[model samples]
Target: MSVRTLPLVFINLGGEMLYILDQRLRAFNTSEDNSEKGVWSENDRKRVMNDIVGTLFSKSFMDELLKPQQLYSHRTMKTVLTRLAHTSIMRLNPASMDRLYELMIMAFKHQVFLCPRPKDLLLISYNHIDTIKEFVKDTPVVVNQVNETHRKIIEVYSSLSEGEFQLLRQTLLIFCQDMNIRVSLFLKIKIQNPNGRFAMTTAGPVPHGIDVPGLIRTFDSKGREVRRREFPNGGSYTSPIREGSFELHGDRVIRLGVNMYTADHPEETHTTKTPSVKPNDTPNLLAKEELNLLARLMGSVKAVNMPGAEPGFRINLFNTDQEEDEAGASAGAGESLFGVINIQAMQDEQVATELALIAGQFAEKEEESENQSANKGDELLAMMDDL
Candidate 1:
């Protein structure tokens, strides 16, 4: 997948693929899995995403966009990672951490995992004056809020490795705690199964781990074990697997990067959550839907930073209009699960201060060079006068 440019603004792409997805979903609904509770496959990630989108964007939502609607980095994703931990995710494509660390070590740079070229930082925010004026100063209420925020942060902080701990403290925290933020931390996970096997079967009411022959172990979105019963001594040893990511939208978590198929009615009906089609739903929608459907046929997935990530994290899903309203109150200027970033939404003073500092450094260097030039000029004048 092309690693699209960063500073990706979240926008909905509509059209024919939406219809294809709708159609594919209809087929899936009638599939055998729907009739019974089956062990989740890597494909379950798609189901999770469909469930999430369907839940969020009800039939008429686009005409009436959901409350607290915000943009996504990109709805289209390449890979869905099944196993993740509390670590920094570069907006850029996945790269070797060891290699980046080596480069940083050689350069004697403190931030090991940061985008090496500072200019590559699509957007960086300095703290707003309010951080000092409104948040950090002696106001009792603000002070309490600051402490509460920091306290929660520290909890996540403790669970990290030394390198990650430093990165969070130095880089991610400054952006996350206040409105002047830049990035968010991410927790990756895998498919979940209670039993250690991947091919599982339930002979009776209870789900059981089968030991037929060659079974694999896996995890789910929340990192619970994906137990499976052993496959019969099969011809081919490998089963092609799929992957996914648990995407964060504000405080709510949804699954994304799901190349799965569950159909939506191309045309909206009042009976279900399938969103109403608008004129803008373009032709390319078919390609989009087919791609996702193919991924589902293929199946896999992968968090939040609530720390203590030994076994896995616990996730709870609930949506209420009242909660969304409350969310608006707390959401940052550009809130993200990776980290809260203020983006360029900072106060003028912060920006000016940064520019001033850069200008000052250049001015000092220029002055020093001019002084050297003047000294050389005087020496040449003395030589000429002597001649």
Candidate 2:
């Protein structure tokens, strides 16, 4: 496996997470019932964005992450992201968090699979960084943190050989192998087949630095071109447009990692539990030593909790709390293959005990609204059923 693949995976997945959160936060802010709960104001949105982005691109964390190392196991990575998402006052219950992570993995997997060239992975990462910068434009410190990491990305990846890039891409593909969870957005756009694999189009422009198919050239013994011929190719193709800028600031040309969520085209975060095929039964278990190392790297950043007077609310990825509960129940029974990895009990007791402790750091806050009044809960349930 390529040592360089981990950064791309983390950055792209983090970007997708931000996109989903931003959309959901906006929806909450505009809801008519927002006033009943604490209103999700513009200031609240900015605080959440600033806190999460700052933690994600913090200098200490990024420094450790940039070092060459093996890719993290799925559980370890999920644990790390769980910590990151809870850095702000926002919270996710077990079920909502599982759905949120599934959406993130599948979204990034789609982008990597459709990338035109292995080298274009850098462009995709840059697109994410650029959009992240936009999210925290008002905070100079957070913007600088993002900028510093962007420069580090360029310094490390810009000079890599083509073969190295190919290896990096292959490593990513292996990580996402068999992760065919169905996403509603992808299905609506017709880019994903009913069975969960993405559909590739043959009519787009060829990858940069590549010649369109249908030309044949014959060379002589003296190493000179002797004959040239053209044949009818079945598909239409065109020359690639200009290469995207690899610098810290510019258009990224390709749109793979850019934020697809917007006010005009809103998207809900829903995913099916069943995959197209049964995933591998064997688990990719994490060793105790590796878990300790990851804990050390992540231990420095603590998730902030709201004061007693300030209220924290949960963000549900499903349409309603009842839907989230049902999904969580199925997953608890090991019936759902989240991100193609079965959430089985770890064989190593030490590792399992340690991960539980780490997870407790971001445990969901109590839903005060639910406990406040039974009549309110009934009214909400009645409203949802009516809808």
Worst lDDT window (10 residues) for model 1? 2-11
lDDT tens readout by residue for model 2, 1-387: 898877788888888899888888777675444465744656777888898888878876676678776676565567667767877778888788877888898888877866778998887899999999999999999999999999999999998999999999999998887778788777776777887787766676778888999999999999999999999878887787766421111222226788877644445476775545444444423234444544554443223342554556567777777887887787677644445746775489888889888776534222232222222222222322222
Model 2: residues >4 Å from true position, as ranges? 30-35, 229-234, 244-254, 263-267, 276-311, 334-387
Counting clashing residue pairs in each candidate, in order, gives 54, 0
Q: For model 1, state the Cα shift of residue 81 in Å.
A: 24
Candidate 2 has its poorest 10 consecutive residues by lDDT at 245-254
Best by TM-score: 2
lDDT of 1 by residue, 1-387 (tens): 111111111111111122222333343343434343422222432433333233222222222222222211111212111111011111111222111111211111112112222221211111111122221243354344334433433343245454543432344323212211111111111111222111212221111222233567778999999775655554422321222112223454422211122223212210111122222223344335544543453232222223653222112111233543443443332123334447675579988899999999987885565444333323322222222
User: Positional deviation of 322 in candidate 2, in angstroms?
Assistant: 0.9
Q: Which pairs clash in model 2? A: none
